[model samples]
Target chain A: MSNATQPTAKPDERVKEISAFRNALIRPELGGIVGTVAVFTFFLLFAFDSGMFNSQGIMNWSVVSAQFMIIAVGACLLMIAGEFDLSVGSMIGFAGMMIAIFSVTYGWPVWAAIIVTFVLCTAIGALNGWIVIRTGLPSFIVTLAFLFILRGFTIFLPQVIERKTIIGGILDVAEGDWLAPVFGGTIFKGLFVWLGEAGLIATFERGTKQGQPVVDGIPMLIIWAIALIIFGHVLLTKTKFGNWIFAAGGDAEAARNSGVPVNRVKILMFMFTAFCATVFAVCQVMEFGSAGADRGLLKEFEAIIAVVIGGALLTGGYGSVLGAALGALIFGVVQQGLFFAGVESSLFRVFLGVILLGAVILNTYIRRIITGER
Target chain B: MTGNSKFHHGDPKGAVQPIIEMKNIEKHFGRVIALAGVSFDVKPGECHCLLGDNGAGKSTFIKTMSGVHQPTAGEIFFEGKPMHFDDPRDAISAGIATVHQHLAMIPLMSVSRNFFMGNEPTRKVAGISFFDKKRADEVTMEEMRKMGINLRGPDQAVGTLSGGERQTVAIARAVHFGAKILILDEPTSALGVRQTSNVLATIDRVRKQGIGVVFISHNVRHALAVGDRFTVLNRGQTLGTAARGEISPEELQDLMAGGQELAQLEGSLGGTV
Candidate 1:
């Protein structure tokens, strides 16, 4: 209470020097780092013979982690911006189906279909934002409505067009398309081919496709996930808009009072989330060469679980993309390692629930220590 | 009645026009009238104290001026131009800053982040402008030092600071953002004596910088101690305006506590005590 101006207002010299290591320990990603290491080590112990630690195994997990990371990073950002997009999972399915329908059945070019999908996804995101802001309703409720709406549309659209739940022929469309390589093709295909020829990689035998590596090249999904994480990190920590997200999430009224345009920040966050879902859909549709109404089912919960495990506060205003990236890694290990260890795959969901609850409790406890909040 | 005391009123040197002139400002929340026909103004380099008891429409008046609540009737003239803010953002853009009672600080954010909440310092690096953390910390520390708050570091969380220290940070942030008119609502109501004195001193410092200040308070002593001009509000209406040395603290208190009518009523009903 002694607010009286002191004679000297210099920084306290007797304050203990903050060592580099301690400062690093208090970073928001600490729990995610520990969780990743623990999960990896546990998998290493149980699945060593399964070769989950080998290059091929690592690549497998990386692909799986990449799939989750692409969505989780965006979800993490949205969570930090103080919102939830339950519809993201549904958006992926809807977008994938739309892209396939537009390109293959409707006779549109692959790139044009992608462009149309982008516009449609952006509009959906904007609508979510507008409704949430205009009605002053919680985004959870609003996006849930979108979830059912999009899921129903995804199911009904394919049924009406192709007379089935699945939309195929996208792979055929992708075969001759110029942009296919950018979205779904392997990056080191030529290098892997050379490696296979040099006997550095395992290859198929007694066939026209003999003497080729088991894994041809890095999947674009992995590349996209890494890129998204880096982009999300920079956008969250280094930009003015990043500051706005933290401020808006931390205290919306306070942020608005500071002239942050909280409404616009939130709307943009919703759009970015939808945009991420669309990206995931585009890559996945091309990767699998087919789109189904069931595609990306329960993906919203997985992404959110990944984010929460990454150390984001559910109440909002705090999170890290790196943590989310590591969380996705942990998730990938848990799922793939269980299969490798002969454990039931169904157990992974239960494990996800426990990890989420534990990580959140740990995150909240750590945050309290850092903030010294009672 | 402009009798025996010295009062600084109307105009001060070089303050040709009032920095903010609010006339007949009225705010109605649905059927309930929060503020009715309340007019107040603050001149440049002057500390205008708005005195009112709880439920005296003081909060509503503050909200109206600061753009939390738009006036249903009357007008606000900022820098001699009539202005109606769509919200607080427009009010802030027009160079008016409001520090609410809670101070509107994000507790979990770092001091530097809180200091530069809406408008952070950024510098272009690698074709992208970053938050400029180094500059932010340096400036946050420097601004706080000017306000006589010596912190260990700018990265320290704001919630860990004392109540008074947080108030100083809020004031420093307000000043740093180039606010021409500063409105503080119940700044010292929740503060201790020493904190109150600190805030009063900060107000003195702010006033010396030539920015007009509207300090809302019910405590006559505190208001008279720091205020250059005083406007007392009652029942969503203004009792009157006075100035330093023009009216004693006792007279101002009477006016703020409900003038002669309350005194006469108390006499007729006999003292409850």
Candidate 2:
């Protein structure tokens, strides 16, 4: 083996470069990147005439990916910190209901309702963290319990207080409010409209307006998702706290011995997950102009799958926010792509399962190489 | 190995006070007694071996000293000043660092990241302050080199390192953080002969830096090789503390019950081999 690769007789005196470029190419996110390309191409070939490649179609999937990523970013960070928050999906439903009932039924301003919802969600997240830490229970079980508790409350509260399963009037309550634009609705809507009007984008051949295209303004969810991903990426990779999160997840005892406040880091991670869920709830309420008790169902699973596909270990401590973002994108494209191709929507779960299995296996193989594990 | 002469290079000679002095320390784990009234002291710039067999309270004593558990009753003095540590961080802040057998370095993290860990360096990039990767890499390499560990890449994950190298990283990290007293828990138990020598050499280098070293081990030969002084423990009590030359390796083993156990095993075998 030693004789196979011979070195020069004399070492180079000047600075010599190693194959650093190759090393950079095989980063942990490479699996996600490769998987995304393969999936995108496969769909592109079969679904070409289905408008899946069109700008509107792309935007539709991107919006879906954004919604998934907002929570996935949080879930990814929490996973890196060695925990899970299954209640995030339930928190979404609960937060939406809180915002709706407070504003529409109690006559509270939309802004006040949003603030209260966030505070309540934050508290619920802390309780999840606290119970897990204090009682020394598995976060999976604790958050699973929280999942049911919050979901039950979301459904039960509307029946008891609002006397309704679904509450409307979210946009009506948000109307004429200063804070509405911040938490709800679109941005640069007029700009996109202007672009469409200027023939920069495809316009309708025949419609009520004659020229306006079906593609509307950029969704606020997409903007918030990108911003949150940046924040999560920095917080996971740039800060001292980020280092602590990795250490804590990799080995909690080792991290504690190293003087990392693991409990605090995990608790803060749980809070972030809840906060992301709340953001999703706000956007959904704004987008639909209505709130339902069953909103955000199975979102936690989507976020976890995205995080896992992004190359995070289900056991924790190894992942990237960018990878999770890519994972979300993959899920969104496949889910929407199949629909555009006229495939049955129920097959989406099967597709999700197959993709999750393949991504995880690929991720595991990549991780073995990165960790140099035999 | 037997005299003050072994400590010629920067070793605290003749008149230095003990870095840490534990007096009549006692610890209990609920219904079980892990350690019973034991006294230990480590002076600056010398390897003090804590010799014991399994369940001999060596681990418990180290934990108590390192602040993993509060002593049920005892007093600990740091540099002759009585101190109390509620957590490991307190002890660490007081310049005492413990390298447990399963060293504190996270295997998945890079050498530099593991080295900095909770005490990372930070700098601003595009007006956003973050952990300073450049500084961490530089210092980790420098400290490791000082310990005779020349790592080719600071970003290499620590899990890829051998046991002895991981121990070296832990020691280097402790030294980097300005630890005055180093507590190594069975540092060489799982290492091969070559790796054990590497660890011993690191201990020697650390001692030359004028830091107190507590070397916990069951191997008498290994301890006798570098230890300036040795303290023997048996069943949670101090058998005796001996300075180098005060006792031989064979004698230390006897005190740790190694001789008796060997004799019992020989009797059990009844001269079959």
Candidate 3:
């Protein structure tokens, strides 16, 4: 692939250059791209007339995918730094519950509740990294322990403070809160209204909301996802710190010898993962106007699955944030496409399993080609 | 050995003050005396080979010199100034670079990435620092070319390169980063004959560039091939230091094998037990 661009008349005879086609096949994003195109094609073929591609339907799946993309970005970075945070789901549930308990039960301002929850969750994330680094334990076991601990606190706290495992009326307290809009609010409302007036999209026909676009505007969740994806991609590919992340994950000892601060990198990645989870939690809380103990269930695994499907090696060091985002997009499309196509929704799990396996196989083959290993 | 005629003992270039000098260096790990009063020095443009049999304190001595281990007692002078290195990074900043047998490089990363791993060149765009990948790639190719390794591309992974090329990458990196004294530990131990020759030639090039080299190996032939001066370590102490032509390969091997110990063992076991 790199040979074609070289203007040098004589190529280095020593380098047994693989063909450009095979070189293209070795990109980490190939699996994710293929999977994404295939999923979109499948949905477009079977669910086309079912309104899956309509404005509202597109918004629905895009929101769902943006959620996965947010967390997958964090998980992908952490994994590439050679760590895992099984507590991501629990962190979400805990963060949401904390916001509800502070704002609703304790009568705190919604903004304060959200900010405090972010700080607290980020601290917990740091603690996770600290323990992993100081004890030399596998991050898998350390984070798995926090998963149950945080989940237990999530359920126990709301019940103790409000006499219920669920908290509601966050929307009422957050009605005029300045910060609430950033997480729960939409953008381009005027544009959507224009879109409706221009007959570019469908509008409500018979309610008090008549003449309004069915999709009010783009959600903040999607905005956050795209921003994070861009941020992560640039950080990984264009910065020296990004190079350090790869080196740290690829070989910690070697990276250390080369003067890369491997420990600090891993710890920051864990904190970033927690920050992402908190972002998801806050968005979900604001959108639903409530918090539940069962919120974000199995989300950690889903995020990992998305990252893996996007072509990240489970062993760490080799991955792409864009690939993970595409994986998240695939997840969202397939999950909703099943509903749109009128298939059994439960089959989504089976599809995830199959796609995950196929991606791993493809990624393994690419790894072998890059490493020249059989 | 073919280049032996090109160097002479006490050559004018070797008469300069040593770039790095260790005096009465000692290291202890609990009760084990890893190094005992070993004095060595390398002048600019000189390849000083440290040869020893296995477990002869060569590894510990080099580790101490490279700042991986602090000497228990010693005086280290760089450019005639006493120095203390808290860690490897400190030594690196002082222009002492060590390329261990296991090169400190990520195998899966591209050549340019691995070449500029820690000390990455960055260009500021709109007040945001981004890796200067064009410069890094160009410099990596140029450096590798200087070492006579024609890379396919800078994007090629380090793992795909032969052992000899990898060594050249490391040496070129150290030299590029302004390493005044280069310490190589067992660079040729695991390489084939052709690869070993390539690395030795690279060492010769680095030496000619006025960088002091401490080449560590037990392979007598390898040391003799590139060494300007030879120091033999035996049982945690230096037997002696000899200029290139002052010592023959057989004599260097005998010293590294611990001549006194070999004779004692021969007396006890009839020489071939």
Candidate 4:
């Protein structure tokens, strides 16, 4: 009874001070950015031996990096929602095959084939979501089964339509002019190309018979990748669906109790991942003019590796779409850098494995420190 | 205590029904009967205390009331009208909010974010969505001020807050969202004496706002201090109900221990050895 009415220190003040301190060090995507930079620097150092330090080599690597970045961004969002789609690689091959079978074999218009293939691909994605929701089974198992199913379908699909192992219509989109400017176009011409060649004068152009600029123009894939990255960043940071994705992965039980439709969110995540795979398939088909069963083989592992390297937690709940795109860029740079550096192409797998493992370990330790678990 | 005199003068016609009423509520988890024929009432603007030992159906009762589980047999009336709740959302929509002992909050999320997690403010243009962080932060800070919670900012992660502060935040959030019937499950069980006082003060504040409060706690002294009426439950059954004036601290303790039943239990324990 001595001082029952005395004022005390406010609780919110203390909480705010501590939270401000925590925010200064725990950036959501810092780990991924750091890992990407580290890998890029490593490759850049080795790349000098094979003239990869030159502007032309840099432009070529950048072009190759763009495709992986686009697909990885979408994969990152799906992973953040607490599910995976191993069937993405197969979906890519299937979409490419569908476009080829329709446009080339059936003699349909390219635009119509593209639209139809996309619709069919989206349907396949919805089907995958339906199966997972109905069975209440692990998505890893379900999507793995789907991967095999799609692979078999892709191989047998051509035989059914054309009475042969090979299909002809795929070559049109892969090497066609109508889509070249959109999907397979180059971007580094005009001012940038002239500026890159200005300093080198005619000697640099003379060394190469083709008289191409010292640096090639930016690739269309790079433009697409940048656009996708911006869109994904906006979607993840500013949307209600983005918040739901974080909540679903953070704690499914708590989210469900809070009235979030966890099942629907997970299903939508899977469908989005599949849609990304289909988009990538269309791009690949345009670039290669062939829709073979092996078009996207093992690409799923690359996408997952990119996400993991980008600092996405294996257990979900924390990561960034931007980080995943950066990770894919790192992968592409390393792949092209090694080729230019005269490293045996067969040894690329070992090098990638080491880099991926290192990134995972670093990501785990950083996460632990951020959470104050160690 | 003069219950007959108070009954005659205080209640008048005794026509005012409870804001919430539960009768003959039975709940079972497989073979175990968690609650059997339990009944209780909460009057408006009064702090009703539910006292019990551990495993005396407190959790079961709270769950049933919050719509986590449908009671096996029961009649529940809200404002003299029968109602059915299929889920926690249903209870929430009905102005019945529950603050559990553990508190349901995402630790990694900030205070304001957690406060407005499900009911977030959004801005939409051309069917695309955008979260209004500025509005959310502003509204959350205003709510905190109204609840007398002095915080440095709304950006602090809720995990960093002390246990009593977290409970206060949860209670404040529920109250801000228009909860009329607030159920606090063991709110002070995990707190120290000072924190316990803070929670009791919060309960009093809630009652003063004309909200019916069901405060569940095992601490007899604390319950007696804040409670206007006390109901005792033993083995999932109602032992008795007593007005705060009708029971002394020691008498309430005895009733909570099952009085005669406890004496028989002591005798058996002493004789067996």
| Global lDDT of each candidate | 0.85, 0.84, 0.90, 0.76
On a 0 to 1 TM-score scale, where does candidate 1 land against the true structure? Answer: 0.91
Model 4 regions more than 4 Å off:
A1-8, A11-23, A43-55, A159-168, A171-182, A185-218, B1-17, B26-36, B53-55, B70-74, B124-127, B142-153, B188-201, B218-222, B248-261, B264-273
Compute the lDDT of residue A336 as modeled in candidate 1. 86
RMSD to the true structure for each prediction, in A, is: 3.5, 5.1, 4.6, 4.7
TM-score winner:
3
| lDDT, residue B271, model 2 | 33
Identify the CAPRI category of the predicted complex in candidate 1: acceptable
Top model number, lDDT: 3
TM-score each candidate: 0.91, 0.91, 0.94, 0.84
Quality of candidate 4's docking, in CAPRI categories? acceptable
* Fnat per model, in the order shown: 0.50, 0.47, 0.51, 0.19
Q: What are the per-residue Cα lDDT tens digits for candidate 2 across A76-95?
A: 99998899989888999999
- Quote fnat for model 4: 0.19
Best prediction by DockQ: 1
Residue B257 shift from truth in candidate 4, angstroms: 5.7
- What is residue B245's positional error in candidate 4, in angstroms? 4.2
Candidate 3: list runs displaced more than 4 Å: A1-15, B1-14, B260-273
Which digits, one per residue and each the tens of the lDDT, describe model 3 over residues B88-198?
Answer: 888999899999887898888999999999999999999999999999999999987777777778999888877877888999999999999999999999999777877
lDDT tens per residue, model 2, B116-198: 99899999878877998888999988787776665658977787677888998999889988999999999999999877887
DockQ of each: 0.46, 0.37, 0.42, 0.31
Off by over 4 Å in 1: A1-4, A10-23, A194-201, B1-17, B23-39, B67-90, B260-273
lDDT (10s digit) by residue, model 4, range B1-273: 223232221232346678888888999889999999888888888888899988888888978888888999999888889988898888989988898876766655667877876777799878876877788888888876765567667766665566777788888888888988999999999998877777777888788899999999888888987998888778898776777797777556656676776557757887331
Model 2 score (lDDT): 0.84
